[model samples]
Target: MKPELISFKLCPFVQRSVIVLEEKGIDYDITYINLKEPPQWFKTISPLGKVPLLKVGNAVLFESAVIMEYLDEVNPPSLHPTDPLRKAHNRAWVEFASTLFFCQFNMVMAKEQEACDSAEQELRDKLTQVEQQVEGPLFNGEVFSLVDAAYAPLFMRIAFLEKWHPMGLLDQTPKLQRWSEALLKRESVKNSVVEDLEQLYRDHISASNGFGASRFGNA
Candidate 1:
């Protein structure tokens, strides 16, 4: 049976797993569901009632990082290093990427400018740490590891946010800035979501009337 991925169109977590699947050249079916009103079947399969659920054979997987690791192990040409320590090191960076996403989420949900400012500065500080540790063109050099998959969405959202406001998160991190630009061009990153993702994101933030969206109004 072909693998199936349950996803929400705008979800970055879902996109992380999608990029892995695409990079592996795996033939899988994807089902996009409304997260707001998830169907009973989705609720039944997803332990956390979250997306990027992978149905492989009889097994179901939750959590994007877990799913990415599973896919890497099951498939050939592993995205992670072979050495145990190296793999663990990459995994640590993957966790860091998750933290960055959480910070980005907080920034997006911030209703007040002061809250958004705090979240944005926090995210910038975290990115600076990543910038200090960055290896190069990709997270782990030329090889695109799970770290890259995890971070692609963060940069994608930043790309959207940059259109509405000035985000100098990369001003001091030229290497990270280049990495973001490179990830944005990857086919998997570009194809992971519905077309017009920027528009959808803008709509979502505008609907919330968050600080990011409010900038456009004040401008």
Candidate 2:
């Protein structure tokens, strides 16, 4: 059965899985929901009340990382490293990428400059760690693994964020910069999000009316 992914367009989690689905050429369906006012059916199926719920026949899976891993496993030619230790390492880094996504969101929604500054520093620090891990031109070199699929959504958001305001988040991490460039250029990553994702981000930032919104709201 073709899996159906419940998602919110603004969700990076959904985008992560979407990239995997796209990369694997999986035939699936995606249902977009407003997370702020989620539907009754969604509330019933989702335990944590999150997006990117993978409904595969009778079984339902939540969590983007889990969904991505499941897709990789079910599909032929796994995206993870063949070595046991290396696969585990990639999984750990994918978890780290999740933290970085939250940090970037916090920075964007920060109502005060102090909060934004702190979030920026924390994000940059985390990105520096990711930089050291990059084997380039992708996360684990030429082959795009699950970890690469995981980080692509974050980089896509950062690209938009950088366009609005040049924070140089990738400046200190030349390797990540190169990695980000590669992921952003990939067909799967580009096709993962909605066509108007950037405009949606702009509207979202303006609506936020926070420190970040004030600076890039007009942009």
Question: Judged by lDDT, which candidate is best?
Answer: 2
Residue 34 lDDT in candidate 2 = 92
Q: Give the per-residue lDDT digits (tens) of candidate 2, residues 11-92.
A: 8989999999999999999999999899999999999999889999999999999999999999989999999999999999
Q: Each prediction's Cα lDDT score?
A: 0.86, 0.92
Worst 10 residues of 1 by lDDT: 210-219
Error of 1 at 90 (Å): 0.9
Residues 1-219, candidate 1: write the lDDT tens digits: 688999988899999999999988989999989998999999998998898899989899999999999988889888997888978988898888888888887787787888888888899999999997778998878888888999999999888787678767788889989999999999998888889877777777777777755763232
RMSD of each: 1.6, 0.9
Q: Candidate 2 local accuracy as lDDT?
A: 0.92
| Residue-level error in angstroms, candidate 2, position 158 | 0.8
Best by TM-score: 2
* TM-score, prediction 2: 0.98
Residue 43 of model 1, lDDT score:
93
